[model samples]
Target: MMKIVADENIPLLHNFFSDIGPIETFPGRELNAQNVGDADILLVRSVTNVDEGLLKNSNVKFVGTCTIGMDHIDTEYLQQNNIAFASAPGCNATSVVEYVVSALSSLTESNGLNLEKIRVGVVGCGNVGSRVVETLKRLGIDVCCNDPLIDQTGLVSFDEILSCDVITLHTPLTKDGPYPTHHMFNDEVLSRLKEEQILINTGRGAVVDGRALKHKLQKQPSFTAVLDVWESEPAIDIELANLVTIGTPHIAGYSLDGKVAGTEMIYQAMCRHFGLPSRHKAAQFIPSPPLSKLYFTSEAELSWSMHTAIRACYDVRHDHYALMSSLSGTEVQRSQAFDQLRKSYRPRREFSTIKVLLKNTDSSMHSQFKALGFNVKSA
Candidate 1:
């Protein structure tokens, strides 16, 4: 039997891959050369650093990460050593999009601002960003997109995106290249943000300079910031955490559906690489959602009904409060708490899992709900 090493935090590992081989589990951050030395396959999340240091003496032939981002893995080294690797791209795109919508709903409600009147600027047009743009547009919300790499006509400039009512980032972290994103929002760019503008980052933490952001928030105080990712994460700045409107341990993509989908994607890849018959599917492994159905009457306001339904499925405030309450000790303690929150994250299903029953609703509203990935039923 083949030996497999996997991150303990990854969901549905045993259910899907246990039939293939005996799987050894470890905390992603604690995975080292010694622990993975004799394994034939290694599976991990973003917390593990997969490099030559960890695999130099290992017999690991295949590596996979059940996460969207790949910054934690050294692809160059893996390629040089003839190790096959795979990452689940776009698996969590819907989850992140739902997070942005939930945050915006809470932000607008608290501030007494009209959602339709706000212009949202999406900074990256990849898998996650494109979904955000599509969802916002379907709701009659104005959205401007900025992605230099994509060749779509009428792409907005970066400067135009900066001046929008809300700015959300979904770009990867790149430090040294033609279009580097590391510190993309430096002091100069951050200074340009108006008091009315709200900034939300669900992308990589280092994309924005954390120290600069903290200092700017200290001076401005009126600038609204919603941060799900931070620089030097796990040890993220406490002051910045306090300053942000909504702060969360990096778990925007922790939805049970998304995590299971990621695992399934990588599992199929591994099975194909080894020419084994793949027998697992994500839908079969997903458990019943906490909120399975919501009913809306004819008198229900479209915006209110939508907001209530989305929040019912997964509310962002629960996570925000959890992070705020966890960071009450020394830096190391806070760091441990941050990781613990992620490890013990509760099961959250996506919009599609919940069915919305609408009475006397128009075709437009029904179409909108369907477009947002909701199961819509007319009564």
Candidate 2:
């Protein structure tokens, strides 16, 4: 039997993997040299620090993280030690894209920002960034991209992104490199930003300088932020929590489909490593419910209808604004509360899960719903 050690935080995985091996799980903080020494395979989420200290004397041969980001794992050390590892990437692209769309539409309505003329700069052209670009383009907005890795194909530079009306970051975290993203958005970078610009970060928290961000928000309170990830994470900055517009524990990729995909990917990796037959199966996703067959003849009713449909997926700005309002008195309790709230959040269906039923006639409304990822069908 393969001796496996996994992170304690993942839900429903212990039971799923129980039959495979005698697995021992440790909370990320509990992992140390003494405890991890005997394991041959290690499975983890983003929290556990898999480095030389933890694996210096271990017999670990394989590492698997059920998360999109692999910054926590020491890739150089792993390669030097001849250990193989796999991570689930692009697993939550659609889920995060839907989150961004719902939040943007809702914020436009509430903040009175005109969406038609806005320019959005998306940093990182990987899976998540590409999806956000596609959604923004479909809505007829100008979306610029900045990814050094990708060849220039309608891509813009990092300096150009600073001038955009809205900027969202989706880059991975690297502590040391020629382009170190650890604390990439420092005081100097924040000072260069337009006072009215909106910033969003769903990538690693260290990607943006938290203290600098708080200072910037203080100087220009009108500038907004939608932060799904933070610098210290569960040990997030309390005072800074009050500064940004949106706040959530790093659960941007926590959609049901994303979580399921992560599990399936890890399972497949384990199967291949152990030379075991795959027990993985595809999800039988229930088809989206059809939209209302009754036509909304009135323009007022039509707006409400569209609003409700988007809200079902998620409203990104609402959470940010709520955290901002509460962080004044609640900053000390912010991290724990944030984690609890995320753990208890109800399931949110994605845009692809919803279908639209068209009635006789309005071409504009029909086209709009179809554009929003609703499968339109004649009633």
Candidate 3:
């Protein structure tokens, strides 16, 4: 029988594939070759680096990642090591896009920010950014795009992105490229931003300089920010987290449907490559309880309803802000603060988790969510 070892973060794998082979589960950090010993196939998330260091003397022949991003995997190394690897791409694009749009709608309503006339710029028009652009355009918003790699395939320039009313980044963390985004938005670049514009980054964390953003936030007074990913991950900049309009612990792609889809893709890939039968099934997604009838029908009511819904799922901004505010004096203490909060973060409901509830105002809205595979129920 083939030996298989899977990362703990991957859900519902054992029950789906237990009869396929002898399987073992370990924490992501414990997936290094030394720990897994003689496993023939290794399944991972983005956490376990599948580089030479972790697999030098291992017997692992096949590697599969349950994630959209392959930046964590060393493709060149895997190719040289004769390791066949696969990743589930575009699986969580819709999930993440929905998260960004819903969050934006909530932020604007709560903070009274106007989106009607706002010029939105999206960087890196890949799976996630492309969906975001399409959805925003569907909502009748002005949108621009920037991606040099895609520019070779007929994309716009970054200079045009700088002029937008709101900028949202979705590029990968590349340090050396024609359009290197590692620390791309630093102090000098940030100085060029308009005073009233908003900035949102749901992509990689290091793409934006947190310290520089804090400096800009102080100097540029009128600017606002929404960060879902932070530099150094669980060890984020406390002061910057407190100042942003909305912040979250990189859970933008954590929708229930997305997770299941991503895992199923990987499972199917494994079965196909090994000539095993696929038994993956579509999971039944259910939405949250309906909200009480609105007392007043203002933007305030809509804002409050959205806030309650979002908070009911998970409120990363308020909770992280509170964590940082209550930190002890030392930098080490603050670092520990972020780690504790992140490690202890409760499960958040992704867009798929909330059954689609159309407020009866728009028949189009009902159709929209249904098209996106949501279980729509109109009030």
Best by lDDT: 1
Superior candidate under TM-score, 1 versus 3: 1
What is the alpha-carbon lDDT of model 2 when measured against the actual structure?
A: 0.75
Which parts of model 1 are misplaced by more than 4 Å? none
1-379 per-residue lDDT for model 1 (tens digits): 7899999998999998998889999989899999999999999998899999999989999999999999889999999999999999999999999999889878867766688789999999999999999999988899999999889986799999998999999998888778999999999999999987899999999999998889889999888899999988799899999998899999998899999999999999999999999998987878899888888888888878778887888889999999999879999999999999999999989999989999998887798788778999987
Model 3, 217-298: lDDT tens digits are: 8776568788878887556777777777777666677665566677788888888888888875646332342432222122
lDDT of prediction 3: 0.72
Candidate 2 segments exceeding 4 Å error: 282-304, 317-334, 361-367
* Cα displacement (Å) at residue 345, model 3: 4.8
Model 3 alpha-carbon miss at residue 376, Å: 4.1
Count of backbone collisions within predicted model 2: 6
Candidate 2, after superposition: displacement of residue 342 in Å? Answer: 3.7
Q: Highest TM-score among the candidates is held by which one?
A: 1
Ranking by lDDT: 1, 2, 3
For residue 218, what is the lDDT in candidate 3?
A: 79
Give the Cα lDDT of each candidate: 0.91, 0.75, 0.72
Ranking by TM-score: 1, 2, 3
